[model samples]
Target: MANLLSLFKTSGIFHLTPGMVIMWLISLTLIYLAISKQYEPLLLLPIGFGILVVNLPLADLMKPHEGLIWRFYHYGVQWEVIPPLIFLGIGALTDFGPLLARPGLIFLGAGAQAGVYVTFFAANAMGFSVNESATIGIIGGADGPTTIFLAAKLAPHMLGSCAVAAYSYMALVPIIQPPIMRLLTTREERVIRMKKLRKVGRLEKLLFPIISTIVIILLVPAAAPLMAMFMLGNLFREAKVVERLTNVAQNELLNIVTIFLGISVGATMNADNFLQAKIIFIFCLGLFAFCVSTAAGVLLAKLMNLFLKDKINPLLGAAGVSAVPMAARVVHKVGAQEDKKNYLLMYAMGPNVAGVIGTVIAAGIFSTILK
Candidate 1:
């Protein structure tokens, strides 16, 4: 009996404690938010599960390079393989017609990226190394996969802080964007009506992604993996004959990738690695980046309106932050609050899609500078 008891204690399999259990409960809160509040559950669910698994105190699941979780951690994540795959899914899901129909909003998308750069500098000032700062700055783009992709490459150690910040700020887009939008634009600017979007033909839709892939790859070769894959997935969707592939990209492929990616990410968040003062700084810098991105997008549009015959609604600029349809919808809702007849959903999509492209470009820039 004594030898058996000693063996169990030595293994640490029976040493589960109250503090570790509490951490598991806290992680569950993240899961509840993802599941109940509908805040990026695709990521939070598996991430939450990973946290629970790793924190069990007795589980060998995260034991460096030996455990099963560690294999996933080393294979898919450490080598920067998952982000491009996830981007393919995003590309398959994105509708670039709105962006193609309105090219001017592309500038708004670029303008929103100013926040990303600013956050990079801010994080550096706060004492993060250049690579770590760059990873955190991406949170302003509100592109979860891009952030994960970059963090995995540049500062794998900071993945948890960067990923959590990216997703959390994405969920708060409706909340964070509106106040900045309202503060930047006047009632008249909010109520400006936009011309109806021209119907983008199938040829244009197909050419858009193809052309984008070529141009971006030529300009920023580092973006090829993410951008090319994204365009290919989009091509699959727009090809008109790949329904099966598109459906898989949209549902099965995306869901499965998200689950694996999330858990893999969470497993990296062992207390020794995750609980740090730098993480709090990263979190603050992320929020700072998000707010600045919102403000920059709105104000840039206001500036553009001064020189154009057709005034661009400043509200649409908020959508440039890349939370996708959510940011666009927030612009639509806030505009509707000012004048019920005003509708900006279609117009907002231009910047919304641009934000996606902008974030990818930002990721490319990070990849280059980090290299």
Candidate 2:
């Protein structure tokens, strides 16, 4: 009987708790969404699987120094290696032509960050510390890597929930953003078409990453790690001499880092740390921040139309969160719904890419202030 008891105690079934089951259900739900609903499948599928495995009673996948996932989380996430690498991939894939074509759209990206600051105050008012509030608030930016980077820095305990919330909202950008975009804008504003963007020269393209790096890093030295990698990747793409490097950075390197990043982030959400009421609040605040950010972007675009002779499509502003092409696609789709002839994809890309930089800057600011 003693030997049998010992064996049972070592088994996963015997060690399982209700919380473990609940976490499993949550993981399965994410998996279902990824497979069936096709929501951020690349990251969500791995993340969901990671959540499932980490909750398996005796796995010890996240046991400080002696576990597989723990090592991934420690070196990849905690050491801040993965996010910057992901940014490098993003920079390689990015085209500054759209942003350089119309510098004014950068304002929309800066304006959309209203949600991050607004939610910071809201989260703090609800009893979270300044650091925790800043981490949660970054969900507004809708950039998963930035969220993970900030959460690891400011609230490591809250990393799992915050990352899940950020990615979930990012995945649901289509459903969540359309209503806010519609409610805020008139048909006229949505249908307004801006003029074609002027062709950006090769010299301008090459110079952009170099100048941006110098200016942004000088202003926020804390942002150097991410900003530097991002610009370097962009430089690689523009230089035209490093096709091999650009291809590897955007494709192979990104794919590998993404797997490690997703699994490591998910493993952080074991039952002990994730079943609290605050987790629910984090999800709610994240959604609120996202909605507010969307609304703020649209409103700012309308406000800007008052000054410019060439009235811009207000819907383009909705792409000002860092969801990249996803938010930009949503903006183009919404605008096309109003006027099929109007093409806003390239225009939306301006703010869409700008939002990525804007979010990173916001993270740097938070790290500077809260640290």
Across residues 1-371, which tens digit of lDDT does each residue of candidate 1 receive?
99999988877558776656665775888899999998888788888888788877767797877888878877778777777888888888988888888898899999998889999998888888999989999999999989998998899899976898898899888888888898888888889988788889999998988898989999999888889989999999999799899888877888877877899888777766776777788888999999999999999999999898888889988899988788999999999999899889988988998998899999999999789
**TM-score of every candidate relative to the true structure:** 0.95, 0.99
Reference-based TM-score, model 1: 0.95
lDDT of 1: 0.87
Q: What is the number of backbone collisions in each predicted candidate, taken in the order shown?
A: 0, 0
Candidate 2, residue 365: Cα displacement in angstroms equals: 0.3
lDDT string, candidate 2, 102-155, tens digits: 999999998888899999999999999999999999999999999999999999
Off by over 4 Å in 1: 4-8, 11-22
**Clashing residue pairs, candidate 1?**
none
Which number leads on TM-score? 2
